[model samples]
Target: MPNFNNLQYASEPGSPTSPSEDWAQATADLIVVLDGATARTETGCSHGISWYAEHLGKSLLLAAADTTLSLVGVAKSAISRVACLHPECDLTHPGTPSAGIAMLRPDGRYFVLGDVAIVAESTDGIAVIVDERVSQTGVAERAEVDHYLIGTPEKAAALLPMKRAELAARNIPGGYWIAAADPAAADHALVGHLGLDDGAPVAVLTDGAARAEVFGLLDWAGLLDLAVAAGPLELIQRVRAAENSDPLGAKWPRNKASDDATMVTASVAS
Candidate 1:
């Protein structure tokens, strides 16, 4: 029964006009982070990506209150709970609201679905768990989108077809599993237990903040160190600075110029 000393941070990259699509929530014994998948095309749900993420995050936290439930079971329960909230929405639509998920529970249990991640520091070294299936599924389409600069009309056109292809492959065998309309996708998450020394550091990150590592700003260890030292918000500030330096994707060549970033930094209580 490990308790946590945790700090959560989130920021949307572009305008402050709209709410962030990313969400992070935590209790004394649980931490969850979700990166709402940006819908490039029409999604059947009118509640939008942010609404779905908020509801799903709350549902997951509620489901996780039952310590007996496995992480997969919690995910499934949460997904089903959220689904029932909006029966009128066309959940079967390929472009319906979805998200990448990362969670940490007491007893050093961690789970990751889609591209979100859980990172922990152990005596062995830095350990990270994340599902890269989504990245692997949209290769050719992603390559096409990567050819053009971010935010350009050409890039938008390329992104449309890529998003369509990705939606088609999502939650299907040989494609990727995410927190979406299907509860079965929960079974595909990467779930495991790590042996963490008492007071060991852990972090859950959405791809937006994790992309700092992808963009070569810091490795996992360094990211953890930064969060431990300056705090999680500083890590996001660094990511924002990096993104500001390369506003056009001339260097990083990512799908968006900047994304909604969220991170939760915590430590096992001795």
Candidate 2:
């Protein structure tokens, strides 16, 4: 049977005072990571982003344990399960709690939605999978926000229009899909199987942990090497250090100086 060994996992919140909107969990046959979308405007749900991520992550893990279900089916079941948890909320609201998802099954099947990523090494080569549709949506608004330092009033003001645009573009035919109230979003996930070599490296990351690649600090192979040598937490620390070096958006411009980061690393075995 396929299994994972030498697993290393870590998570850190963007702000020390706030609960992390990212969540990760690993079972004998599955690895799941979720990055909750921060609600810049009002979300119709009272349970909030963190709650949505945790419930979705847990539900996905449970559903994936069945092994017989396809990854898309797992995602559909999980989203539907979470939606049932808050029947009183306005699930139809555009800003309803949602998250990016990345999941790996023991047989080398991988599923990705939104910005979360899955990087795996196999006999064929290295494969990195992530959905970049959201990044393509808010170009002008995102550029404006990146001009100012994170946490500044200017940046906050700029984020409002960007977030509004994002909500407007979300889950439409031309827009991106995420784990939310609608189970149909699961059908939009990127899915495939990798012939992962025995003892090959694998990493699943939320976008925050993946910012290193976005910033050109490290390539996917290098990041996996770091995780193997130092540990997964070191990857988070490296990202934090990089973010600290560019606090004012002078070097690397972005909407936030820091974001909730989560990573899971392991070696494939059978």
Model 2 residue 193 lDDT? 92
Models 1 onward score TM values of 0.97, 0.98
Candidate 1 lDDT, 3-51, residue by residue in tens: 8875555555444676788888887788899989988898899899999
Candidate 1 stretches with Cα past 4 Å from truth are 6-8
Best by the TM-score measure:
2
Backbone clashes counted, model 2: 0
Which 10-residue window in model 2 sums to the lowest lDDT?
248-257
Q: Would you list the clashing residue pairs of candidate 2?
A: none
Candidate 1, residue 45: how far the Cα is off, in Å: 1.0
